[model samples]
Target: MPAPRILGAAAVLVLSAVILSACAGTPEEAAPEVTGNAQTPTAAAPEPTATPEPEPASTEKPTCETIISESVVADFESLGWSAQESPLYIGSTEITDGLQCMWADFEGPAGDHGQMYGWAPVTEAEATDAQDELIAQGWQREEDAAGVYITESAETVIAPDAEGYGITYLFGEGDVKVADTKQNLLLIEWPKS
Candidate 1:
């Protein structure tokens, strides 16, 4: 009987609390407000700029005609200097594993005056040794650049006359450019050793 009375008291207290809470004032609605200044854009955005590309390095192996200008070849041909067959030489010294392009002034006396252009897998020491050998063999030493060696001839086929010059431009890739100018020939690149 006491438990039933306590249960009834508890139910009455809960009902009273619910009625009081419902009678309480409802909360006012509050809208979200901007925290900072806001505006529409006045102008269009700028387009991004393009960067320029760099030139690619040359990797193509050189050919006899491609090594030198075609105009120069034509000019030499215009003269009596016609391309001759090769056992590639830099004043009678045979070169190996490279290209050779020669031209001789056959119309000249005894077919003497001519030019040679060659590149070979010759070491720097080998080129220097060849220069030394040429100097030893009476070839007039003209210019001696760091890697290039120039020698004039008194009797060598590179320059059988006093007017000619023998030149070697070492490209330091294990090759040397063996060239001369009496009639007219030139070499520019060499193979790597």
Candidate 2:
């Protein structure tokens, strides 16, 4: 039995020696030799190209004059205003060298409220003719420092309308103020001073 024990110990010692011998080697063989130049890092897929920014859209509002002119004409025509008569004619004139007159009128409750507008380049005779026509139609001259004449009258028998015609005369330069009425609608006189 003692002899068998000795043999077992010897076998264990031999196996351990062989394992240690196999593991013992030069540093180059033990760890893989690193080349002088390190491996090039894979270029990060060329950083995905940045998408270009979109251009800004144009932002601009239409001119005020254009809007005003179009709106006035459209409103006047839509209201069934006749332009053939003395007080209802639609006309444009040069008030001054660079100014212009844009005027229009419609049949009023009394008769016709004649209006004259624009840069006022026309002679005083023309202005008087315009005023006279309105005066003949029972439109009273309005006292305004801004050179605007207004005439207002009420007629309940003509139509079941509540409001009557309000004629306004605009001249000089700038936007014209139009009077709104149920029967006559709107009359505008734009004068380019």
Candidate with the greatest lDDT versus the true structure: 1
Q: Given candidate 1, what's the lDDT at residue 103?
A: 69
lDDT of 2 by residue, 111-175 (tens): 43333222223345655665576567666565546665544444322322354444444433333
- By summed lDDT, which 10 consecutive residues of candidate 2 come out lowest? 85-94
Q: List the residue pairs that clash in candidate 2.
A: 95-119, 95-120, 95-121, 100-119, 101-118, 118-191, 119-192, 173-193
How many clashes does each candidate structure show, in the order listed?
Answer: 4, 8
| Model 2 residue 187 distance off true place after TM-score fit, in angstroms | 11
Local error of candidate 2 at residue 90 (angstroms): 7.2
Estimate, for each residue in 111-137, the C-alpha lDDT of model 1 and write its tens digit.
555566766677777677777776776
RMSD of 2: 21.5
Instruction: Tell me how far the alpha carbon of residue 136 in candidate 2 is from the true structure, in angstroms, after superposition.
Output: 0.9
* lDDT for predicted candidate 1 compared with the true structure: 0.59
Q: Rate the local accuracy (lDDT) of all candidates.
A: 0.59, 0.43
